[model samples]
Target: MATVTESAPSQAGTEKYIPFETSVNYEKVAVGGAFENGRLESSWYKYASYLPHNVPGKQPPLEEFQHQDVGLRADPEKKALLNAPGAVFDEITPAIGTEVHNLQLSSLTSQQRDELALLAAERGVVVFKGQDFADIGKDRQREFGAHFGPLHVHQMGGQVKGYPELLPVYRDFTAGAVDNEIKNNVSSIKWHSDMSYEM
Candidate 1:
């Protein structure tokens, strides 16, 4: 189980609260949004809404937006790709290969591995594509993952032979087919959460 550490109270009697830490690359948090424009503006009503006016003429401090901590795991390749001249999505394919080639998982320092694990925990989902894990079989994957915590067993019919963690993510291409509308035309795919309504 993951543990969250809270900040201790200050000596001056100030209540110190620790905010939630996330693993998702904080720098990429709001990647293409309206807030991209470098401006800090909010409505008067919005500011007043959060304040308590009952205390005579006392006013609350205006809430300032804090940038999310991008964490210590720096990806210079990713950064370069992001800033590359005339770089498009198609160009990113080769860049990803270069990044993967440079990533030595076993050779990572303890602090770096911890940071990665923390990132995975915070993100809830971390995806790696085109990874050649043929040498590391399903059993090895299970054994390595067991170091974290006890693994959960599949509850329904869709369980793998040996590895329960290896859940099948199937998409039936022939599900929504009409007379002429082939499998390729069907855009509606089955969307299900990994574990639904289970706490």
Candidate 2:
């Protein structure tokens, strides 16, 4: 279950107590549109307005999706990918992310691609910056993506005219007809503190 700690007032009520951790000192926000953004001071159980009426999730047959995980299967490939002459790695956390430097994704050997997959699966999120991916053009970009696996067509979000895999996240114009017009509102929102990466 999610947990929270105690909080003290700011300098205005400084005489009461001083804070050791700034993250615990959260101010309550009471406004019109800030409901979801604001962090309310409450226990995980009491904060949400509802309790589960049914069990959380169910298992499904995995024959279609089953495959040897790259992290486990490509152990030897990770060495060649990381130990290249100029390649460098900075693990973001002890657990989650990694930043790989001095390695160009565009010029990877076939084995290095498998190593990349391994690194990604093991690290959870691998970040690479200063890439030539943008200048390579749409065809090259699509080809590179296809090298990983079958391209995922986004069910929602704007796509390029010919390329269905590229989901344009940054949009200034009005949303299309399939946007959150049907059931996406405050009423339909699940406010409970479940493990949600989607939110």
Candidate 3:
């Protein structure tokens, strides 16, 4: 449960974020139309593009998902409220990237995981702060990402030892400033998206 404090503007702007005294799930996630129960659910309804397709038993392709209304498969009532984070909007675009609170990726039901993927898709990106990758472990990280779709094995960058799907990007300033340069620094500072490289 979140101890709601007075709403305040985020560092970037006057957009309000309900501050929490402790680490708590965001109380309300952005949702669209009401479900059969006459209550709004998560932003999953708007994130159809992000949901996985071509699973052996779970979910079908994007076209099939829309046609068959597979979004209703999971019972929202059964979902643990505390496990899901609340949506924090960005000042410019709400769908660009939403911040969520108190979601532990290591442990989530299939439905919960699906909701998360949908949330990410809807929001473009979902931010979870203070995540300890060491504690979550490589396997858990892979599993959590797998919930969205098959993990991507990068052609470039350092793989996480035994896990090819896990790419570690790091910089060692101690080596030297020039060592960190990317291809003569022409496009080193460019904003890149993983989607650009997707097959």
Candidate 4:
């Protein structure tokens, strides 16, 4: 359960996140739509191309999951929000990527958020420069992420304590105490893309 606080730190309106152990069975995660082989095969409705079988699966008798995806769905570049005043766009490659400068992901307007979703989907990837995103605190981070869709609570990887939506990703190099890295999926070689198994 979450508590309500009137402080500035509470970004999800008055509701503030109060973390506790969530009884999510990761193996039974495919709960968005259809079932395959007596088990759920995918989590979210894919708007783009994806191999259904490649969608990760768990065997039958799985637990329920509140599967989610981006909320700000729109035609790519439709709103032209990327062309804002003083904003600059540069391509990472001629084929598949882009980078935006002079715009902070944390302070984007609703229209800008819509356009950003389109830009990211169309470009494959879009990097926003100089974003002190992690430094903004978990409430703000969750608020920012929730704009796209309901925040996906991850199966593996460590979350920022109470904030399950905020997955703390570390580097390839070995660091942190042995006990610190002893959590599930916290091994040195984390071998998965960001939410690729979902959609």
Best by lDDT: 4
- Tens digit of lDDT per residue, candidate 1, span 1-117? 122345554477443333332222222333342222332121212221221212223223323454333334434233442333432222112112112233434333434444545
Sorting all predicted structures by TM-score, with the top scorer first, yields 4, 2, 3, 1
How good is model 1 by TM-score? Answer: 0.35
Candidate 4 global lDDT: 0.54
Cα displacement (angstroms), candidate 1, residue 193, comes to: 2.5
Q: How many clashing residue pairs appear in each of the predictions shown? A: 0, 0, 1, 1
Give the per-residue lDDT of model 3 (tens digit) for 26-130: 123324333334322324343222222222232222231213222245444424423456533232233365565555556567776656555554456666665
Q: 165, model 1: CA deviation in Å?
A: 3.8
Name the weakest run of 10 consecutive residues (lDDT summed) in model 1. Answer: 89-98
Off by over 4 Å in 1: 1-101, 104-113, 121-125, 170-191
Worst 10 residues of 4 by lDDT: 46-55
Candidate 2 lDDT by residue in tens digits, 52-164: 12223432322344345444555554677887779788765456677778888887776777788877876788777777765666677788777676666544444555666
lDDT digits (tens) for residues 97-144 of candidate 4: 676788778777776777777677667877776777756666887888
The per-model lDDT (C-alpha) reads 0.37, 0.53, 0.47, 0.54
How do all the candidates rank in terms of lDDT, highest first? 4, 2, 3, 1
Checking candidate 3 for backbone clashes, the offending pairs are: 26-86
Error of 1 at 142 (Å): 0.4
Stretches > 4 Å off in candidate 3: 1-95, 176-189, 193-198
